[model samples]
Target: MASYQMLVKDVIKRADILLEVIDARFPDETRNNEVERDVARSKKPLIIVLNKCDLVSKEKLEETKSRLSKIAPTVFVSGKNRFGTTMLRHKILETAGIKGREILVGSLGYPNTGKSSVINGVAGKHKTGTSPISGYTKVLQLVNAGSRIMFIDTPGVIPFGENDEYIQGLLSVKDATSLKDPIGVAMKIIEKLCAENKTALESFYHITIGGQDSYDALILIGKQCNFLKKKGEVDDTRAAVRIINDWQKGLLVI
Candidate 1:
């Protein structure tokens, strides 16, 4: 927790404007208390960037957008492909309405949600090192986005402490698998998806495991997906990773 304070607290408090980036595919996951606390404390204008729209289904994207509308101005942008990024910039400008304001905009999101990539894309060159590994950006990085747009980039937030409702929801939607054992996290995801998104699951797998317990469904998914060890025992970690990747990529939309 103390280590996290350096990254989350220090960086979040310093920003004058906050651009909370969330994976567009999973709105529930983006509802982070750390960011929420930051926003509340700072009381600065915030623009929500639903990054990685290209990977999520249209229906899911729409659902995420609707949910986010209540929070702040939201934009869907693909940092990798540069899709919908211009609109994001435009929205940021409009939301800030800060004429000659030295706005400190923080690119915030969970790990692997493409914050560094988006910053580099917006900067029109390689700025921060983007990688598949989680928590790569350890210290807060500031990128030049021309005049009036100084961007503060921070490390991805993965909840570490006990069950906080917001953290639970964030872990669920954001695919925060790296925070804990992947298998346990995957089981949680499968159960939540089974209850909340029947159509999406069916669209992906053509089967329903709504009647089963969360752990049972996880085992079934692991078996079906062939996430097994040498002894033919369920490899919870492997199974969890598979399901989480599928869910994040919209491959499990059945």
Candidate 2:
């Protein structure tokens, strides 16, 4: 992670404006506070970009934007669908307040937070490679974003000591098959869903989670999906992996 920190520092120093890309579903969880502090110390204009807005509701997006806008200029963008990319471009130029010269923009975010997709979205094409898998961007890339805007896309900066399995699972940094404790992560996901948007969870899995805890909910989903082992017991691991996969793929929102 030291190398990643160094890359972020280099980008902050070399670029004029910085974009902190975060998952719109879990803004606070995906944001790197330490990197934001570094950007603050540098006195560079930081834009808080809430990516994957398509997966979230408009009401929730407006609420999150209102809260995050107090810290910096915030923009809701769907990197996958290229939604609000024009607004993002305008925000970049408006924040930079520069003309007749190229503006170097630095992009930072956690793994799988759609940094590359945002770059490509703003560029109006596939300027950088992107994947759902984490750590896909291994090197710093400089792409011309047209209209005198240049972007410095760096690898996702996962803060040091951020090894929590649940957080990693939610961020898509570790996929369903990659997690060591898939069941535990899936339970956490269920708990969050139950608290935040139980209806969506029920609709997605076609299961009623009345008065059931996270584990029971997992078992219920397992039975609903017919993932059973011998003796008609629900396959906890398989069910957990399915939940994680769906959550990572944006099929299960909030």
Candidate 3:
């Protein structure tokens, strides 16, 4: 079990080509600047796989690609639907070209970016363990994508001292089970989602958010979900955790 830093270094060293997975909704936020520097130092062909593209609008996806292209070769992917696996595979083959028939493809991303699912799609199976929680994969686990490609799943590389409660919660890098202020972080998610599209959030959750602040809306959601404690008190923690999990799972959408 290598530490995250050492594990990331191993990923950079082993993989001939790297896929840096970022959430389609918050590509900029999910991206790790340190990982970018490490990839640059490794001099590997780095591809940016915007995971969960299905949740984002076509316009936003295009905008993201336009900006992200400046950072690396970008590809849109919906790991759940396996929507862009063919394109991903092709780009990888093209990038890793000619030197050898067999190529190792590894991924780097902050937590909950669906890196494992994306690579599983690349391999055409549910070969990797994927969860909404952070830090699932502990080390590089090699799986054969085919005769030509060895796919590697690396432990998610998150930065230290992520002071922003909202960022930490949304990215799911912080241990939600141990979070002292789940409702606070959940409010951040609510604020962001509401600011983006209150209608979408309302429609998805089947809860009217009209004139309600994020805190109040979350309590309402807890009620809607029938998550209550003794004396019929709405369980704020349950609702908040559910929201964060849904966001991570892409069920909440972009």
lDDT of 2 by residue, 161-189 (tens): 54577888988888999888999999999
- Which structure is stronger by TM-score: 1 or 3? 3
Query: Which residue pairs in model 3 clash with each other?
Result: none
Q: What is the TM-score of candidate 1?
A: 0.69
Best-fitting candidate, scored by TM-score: 2
lDDT for position 46 in model 1: 79
Q: Which stretches of candidate 2 lie over 4 Å from their true place?
A: 125-139, 159-162
lDDT of 2: 0.87
Superior by TM-score: candidate 1 or candidate 2: 2
Query: To one decimal, what is the Cα RMSD in angstroms of model 3 from the true structure?
Result: 5.3
- Measured by C-alpha RMSD in angstroms, how accurate is candidate 2? 3.9
State the local distance difference test value for candidate 3. 0.80
RMSD (Å) of each candidate, 1 decimal: 5.7, 3.9, 5.3
- Winner on lDDT (1 vs 2): 2
How much lDDT does each candidate structure score? Answer: 0.66, 0.87, 0.80
